[model samples]
Target: MVPRRRGRRPWHRSRAYRLARTAVLVTVLVTVVRCGHDMPHGGAARAGHAAAARPVPPPRPLPRSPATTLRVPSVDVDAPVVGVRLDSAHQLRTPPLDKPQLVGWYQDGPTPGETGTAIAVGHRDSRTGPAVFAALAQVPRGSRIEAGRADGRTAVYTVDRVRVFDRDDFPDKEVYGPSRRPELRILTCGGLYNRRTGYTSNVVVFAHLTATR
Candidate 1:
């Protein structure tokens, strides 16, 4: 009667164990495929995205130029410029009365298109009559000025203001001060005429560089 008992199967050969093994094999295969995709090409794609997201740098600025000619359309001032040195009084030398049509540029200071105040002085009038810059005061605000440079380029400017300061209170620092960008100082005799003291005031035109050609 101890009879008929059936033997149990091993765990490795059971139907549930076989299904688990199949599931594990499928999961391992899927993981291997996912890892392969994420390794080489995915890394390259991230690098490409990073490079595309980078910003481009700006271009460099042009070099400075020396002024040769000056033109102001508003006042009809189109004149050739000549370089002159400082006088014994440590002042900018004036153009000869005989050549009142010429404009004098301060040679020791910044050039026309350089990064500082460029001083240009002219005779407002001569003993005979009107001079080159005689009508400079008539130039309105927001006028345009063009200065030809030695580098075969023209520097364009816009007149910001025109001022007449008495010789006793001339703002030398403002007119000839150091600047971060190219500036222009157009100067001439102005205000009341004094037989003993000459011109009682100085006319100054302030202009800033706006364009270059």
Candidate 2:
């Protein structure tokens, strides 16, 4: 007699498949909750109080010249810095992959070493592996950052603190706020990686413009 074969169940109806689907859904929900909604700089009550406080200091003068290069000996990042306009496709213009250590400056904002936070960004790694800013995570408070301007001047800054924030929770005002003293904010991705979400957090190093040479 000939033997007959049994039919297999569809994937959607399988117990293992159903459990996996449920787990994935749960994970996504949890991630969303953890990320949370964007909160304004302050609530109405705090806004009123802040307004009553002393006025914010004026922004520092833009150099009679703008910077053209950025170098950080401690992190071994030395690359030409380009002006990144607000409307530019990318805020910061980075160097070619060959020079992965290079970072770009947001031209729309304060120049590095100027009052009001100056923003600079670099990659933590490339397809090959550790890239410029790769050692950024290891940078401690008090490290020096230097920027060379085309007008024959250089601005130096000293690290103040390193902070990590979820990408969704990026505190724009705090990072870009005006300051009486010149400041710098170096940023890069950090934290756990999710195959579906990429990087879960950002690492920011805050530095104060301590001197110019």
Best by TM-score: 1
Q: Which digits, one per residue and each the tens of the lDDT, describe model 2 over residues 1-213?
A: 101112422111111111111121122111110111000233344643653344444334446356688777776777777654332222234334444556766555567556655667666665556766767877778888888877777888888888877656666556555566677777666666554345556677888776777
Backbone clashes counted, model 2: 0
The per-model lDDT (C-alpha) reads 0.59, 0.55
- lDDT string for model 1 (95-155, tens) is 6766778887766666666666667777777656788888888888898898887889887
Candidate 1 whole-model C-alpha lDDT, 0 to 1: 0.59
Please list the residue runs of candidate 1 whose C-alpha ends up more than 4 Å from where it truly belongs after superposition: 1-64
Where does model 2 exceed 4 Å of error?
A: 1-62, 88-99
lDDT value for candidate 2?
0.55
Candidate 2's displacement at residue 92, Å, is 6.2
